[model samples]
Target: MDYNFLKSLHIIFVVSWFAGLFYLPRLLVYHVEAQEKDAQAREILSKQFEKMEKLLFNAIMIPAMFLTWITGLSMIYLTWWDSFGSHTWLHLKLCFVVGITIYHFVCRHLIRKFRASEFILTGGQLRLFNEIATILLVAVVFLVIAKNTFDMLMGMGGFIIFAIVIMAAVTIVKKIRSNA
Candidate 1:
């Protein structure tokens, strides 16, 4: 098959993958905020998000990531051949991609609990998480673009800070929910 065709498909898929990554958390924010637990609205929201995630990965993200890596490596093999292993940008991108993938899985587990009515963050906490998610996505974009700088460190640090904030927000929200 044509390399250019694969690369084009790869780019399209990647764009779709990132689009889903961008939107899913926002949906979660809405899902978490709604007070209609075990109601029709909540169930609909859960199903919609589940469908989105499934399509995003199976129909778009996974294939795109695979194509991108394969075509990218093929291009590298055909072009650089020898020095491809030492490419720092590629390495950095790999780290970021893998980290995001791990986060995706963790989010899946959490969202399942959410769907099961076992865990639900309050509206305010959902807002906080939404903000943090936006920041994290921005940080990821910056890391991908900058590729080499104190920015990568900043991104990692941002992730840590956001993680802490999420934890604290969870604690507070749970307290609020329990009290109310």
Candidate 2:
């Protein structure tokens, strides 16, 4: 396959994936904010989220995530296998990618629960989640730009993992609290 073609697809998918990530959380904000007492409003919110999830998950995120990894690995193989081990940027990117994957699954589960309308996180909780995501994304961008040594890359990766763990723990606690 043509390297350029894969590169193009990778970029497109990545942009789409990020779009979905940015917008999905915002949608969740609105969805959770809608009063359950207002049937029409609640319905509208639910419908909007469901629609977003379908497009974001099926059309954008899923495909992008796959293509991003595929193209990334392919590019690595085609161009950077020898350099990969020594490249700090690539190492950092891979670690963040793992973080992204974990967060992706967590988001998927959260969205599913939201679709089910089982519970709503408080605005504060949602905000916290948003902040965590934003910071991790910033770190990813930084690593992409900086591309330092493995030790530095691992430090950033560690921070990302910590952020993810905290987010996941908060979400689980919220779920338990809501159920209670």
Candidate 3:
């Protein structure tokens, strides 16, 4: 298979995986918050959200994640096998990929907990948790785009700042919504 074709497929799967990562947390936020409603409404919304979460995770997220890994690893093996250790950017990107993979499984755990009527995190906390994917996305994209030329110190600083901004925004939004 062509390297470009593998890269393209990897890109597509990354996008799909990120879409699930982005939406699944929001669904969890809704699912957690739904518990605050009246009993009947809570029951209805919980069941619906659970169904949605299951469908999204099983049908979309898992497949996309696996494909992303397969294609990404394929590209790496095909292109970078000989000099993989020399690619600092790729190393960092793989770290971020691992982070996102952990995030993905944490989400799976959350889904199981929700299914078992265990609401461990509040809506606000889940809202903050949702930002993990966004942060990882930024880090991975930046590392890939700035490969080799990327300054480690500046990149880490920028990543920290970006994360702070995102968390602050989420906190502010939560406060604003609570006030309203």
Strongest candidate by TM-score:
3
Best by lDDT: 3
The 0-to-1 C-alpha lDDT of every candidate, in the order given, reads 0.62, 0.73, 0.96
- Give TM per candidate: 0.58, 0.73, 0.98
> Per-prediction count of colliding residue pairs?
0, 0, 0
lDDT of 2 by residue, 43-72 (tens): 877887778776777777788788888887
How well does candidate 3 match the true structure, expressed as C-alpha RMSD? 0.7
lDDT over C-alpha atoms for residue 114 of model 1: 63
- Candidate 3 lDDT (Cα, whole model)? 0.96
Of 1 and 2, the candidate ranking higher by TM-score: 2
Tens digit per residue, CA lDDT, model 3, 1-180? 999999999999999999999999999999999999999999999999999999999999999999999999999999999999999889889999999999999999999999999999999999999999999999999999998888999999999999999999999998898899
What pairs collide in candidate 2? none
Provide C-alpha RMSD values for all models, in order.
5.7, 6.1, 0.7
Error of 3 at 95 (Å): 0.8
Q: Compared with the true structure, what per-residue lDDT tens digits does model 1 show for residues 1-180?
A: 676776576567556656655665666666665546678877777677666655654665566556656765666666556876766655666666676666556556656776676655655555555454455455556655675554556667876787777668767876887799
